[model samples]
Target chain A: LAKTTQPISMDSYEGQEVNITCSHNNIATNDYITWYQQFPSQGPRFIIQGYKTKVTNEVASLFIPADRKSSTLSLPRVSLSDTAVYYCLLNAGNNRKLIWGLGTSLAVNP
Target chain B: EAGVAQSPRYKIIEKRQSVAFWCNPISGHATLYWYQQILGQGPKLLIQFQNNGVVDDSQLPKDRFSAERLKGVDSTLKIQPAKLEDSAVYLCASSPGTSGSPDTQYFGPGTRLTVL
Candidate 1:
């Protein structure tokens, strides 16, 4: 199983860009990094996913280094609605199970 | 297309009592999953089902937890004699393809179980 480590929490102000990084030193070659955001009393919602390099979507951008040992989720011009817990997950093509660690709780203040 | 649907948004029961949760996956989804999310912790996969067959239940406590997906559509997870440690949010998710495929999973609102 691949394990991920990220910050316990983060604080940001509205209109600022927030970046959360996760480290997975033992990640497999076929594993893909995925991010999810969860608000209070709700299930997690998928944000962005990437295999290598960078992948951008309307919601967020995912940047992966060449070693694939670490990945960063960047939220541009974040607002108070972006306040939530963000999770980093490794999805393996061969395995169906997903191992989730304690996510980084982001607080976007006005 | 509707996302995954779980009934009884909240449930409260005493220790040693029985409880059951129902889940209806999205139309045409072939893979279904059940997860347990404890307070201040991430979601933990409890079981996974491929169509109507059980694919994985390794993390599920078989002595007290049992889940079934009948006719490849709806699923039911039952716990006989619940424990205090079982108090958590039960989440249901579904995907269009199997685990080998790179498909995003759709999640439901989840059922919050409170075991007293």
Candidate 2:
């Protein structure tokens, strides 16, 4: 099983870029770093995933260092609607446990 | 394409009672997952299914919780003798089951279970 650690909360204003970092000191070799976003009363939605280096999507970007011990999710020009809890996940190989720690609760203000 | 679907949207039951949640994954998807999300916490993977077979259920509380996916299209998660701590949002997710790598999991709206 792999574990992730993130900040409890973050605050950002609209139109600003936000970066949420997660630490996984014991991450495995075949693990992939993934990020999810969740609003109140709804399920999480996948934001970005990357094995190493950087992976960018329409909504967000995932940056993983070569050591694979940590990853960062960046949201460019965030808006009030981006207010949600952000999760960092370590997908550790097959038949492995998926760990979803208490993620960073991001509050995007107007 | 439609995403994962779960029902009923909300459920309320007293402790010691039993309640069940149903989920329908996206059409043609071969992987389904069930997760439990308590308020103010991230979603925990309760079970994972590949087609009609279970890939993992290590985190599920087997003493009171049970889940099954027959025919591989839909799944049901039942909690017999529910407890107050069982109150949370039950989420269902699905993936394309791409070989060599598991694709992204698309989540549903989730079913909120409130045990009083």
Candidate 3:
């Protein structure tokens, strides 16, 4: 498994674009970048995933640079409901055991 | 589709007591996982099972924590003589067996446990 580094907290106003970046310098050849959002009392929900370049879904967009050392999650026109802890996950072999770290806490203020 | 389900939504016990939590994975999901999430931290995988057999339990504290999945349907996680640090949310998740990566897991609402 690869080690990841992300900011501890971020703040944004309503209707603004927010981008959360995660650095994974040790990403493996087959590792995939995935993001999950966790509310205060709920389990995590999938946001977006990508292997390279950019991948977009209805919920969010994931952008992985060509180097694959880092990735960014872009949320457009955020609202208070989008406030949550965002986790970046990678399955760098290791029998699919995910390395979950303390994620970035995003607070979307009204 | 129905998501993973966990019982007892909440549990409160004193130190050195025992507690148990149950989980029912999504129908037809062959892989089930148990996770512990401390306040302000991400979830830690405790155990993973493929059907009724254990797949990975390296992180499980065998001395006090035990989990079982019978008949490949539902599962139970037990903590004996619990400690104060055991107070956290217990989460259950399931993923399609054929998904291969097991990276995209569907999580339950989670069972909150507070040990005094």
Candidate 4:
């Protein structure tokens, strides 16, 4: 299992773009990067995932560098409702387990 | 499609007491997971079940925490002699059981457990 590190918290104004980056120095060969967002008192919801280069969806976009040592989650046009804790995880071989970290708590201000 | 369903959205219990939480995964989902999330922290995976069979439970406190997914559908997580440190939200999630790669999981509202 690879350990991930992310900023404790971040602040952004409404309509601004927010990027939360996570670093996993010990990532495995088959590891995939996945991100999740959680609001207060709610379960974490999937955001985006990528192995390398970039992956985009209607909700968010995930960018991974060539080294695969770091990944970034970009949220465009943030709103107050977008305030939540974002987690970056590594799905190792067989995808049986997901190692979680403290995650980045993003506060979107209006 | 109905999402994962969890019963008793909130539970308050005293230390040394026992409590149980129930979960119903999405229809056709073959994998179920139990996660514990403390305040201001990320969720910790406690156990994983693949169609009524335990796939991983290394993080589960077997002495106090127990979970079962019977009949490959609904599941229950029980805690015996709960402690103050056990206070957290228990989240249940399910995936479509894909091999060789990670599958997208759908989560429920979660059960908030307060141990005093």
lDDT, candidate 3, A26-60, per-residue tens: 99888988899999989999888888999999989
Task: Name model 3 segments beyond 4 Å from true.
Answer: A92-95, B99-103
Model 4 lDDT per residue over A18-84, tens place: 9999999999888889899989988989888889999999989999999999999999999999999
TM-score (all chains, Cα) for each model: 0.97, 0.95, 0.96, 0.97
Q: Pick by DockQ: which candidate is best?
A: 4
Q: Compute the lDDT for candidate 3.
A: 0.91
Q: Is candidate 2 or candidate 4 better by lDDT?
A: 4
Supply the global lDDT for candidate 4: 0.91
The residue ranges of model 4 lying beyond 4 angstroms of the native Cα positions read none
lDDT of 4 at B48: 94
B1-116 in candidate 2: lDDT tens per residue? 88899999999999999999999999999889999999877788899999999999989999999999999999999999999999999999988877677378889999999999
**Native A-B contacts reproduced, model 1:** 0.58
TM-score for chain B of all predictions: 0.96, 0.97, 0.95, 0.97
Candidate number with the higher TM-score (2 or 4): 4
* Interface RMSD measured for model 4: 1.6
Fraction of native contacts under 8 Å reproduced by each candidate: 0.58, 0.54, 0.52, 0.77
Each prediction's total of clashing residue pairs, residues at least 3 apart in sequence or on different chains, is 0, 0, 0, 0
Q: TM-score (0 to 1) for chain A, all models?
A: 0.97, 0.95, 0.95, 0.95
Q: Please report, in order, the local distance difference test score of every candidate based on alpha carbons.
A: 0.92, 0.90, 0.91, 0.91
Candidate 4 CAPRI-style tier = medium
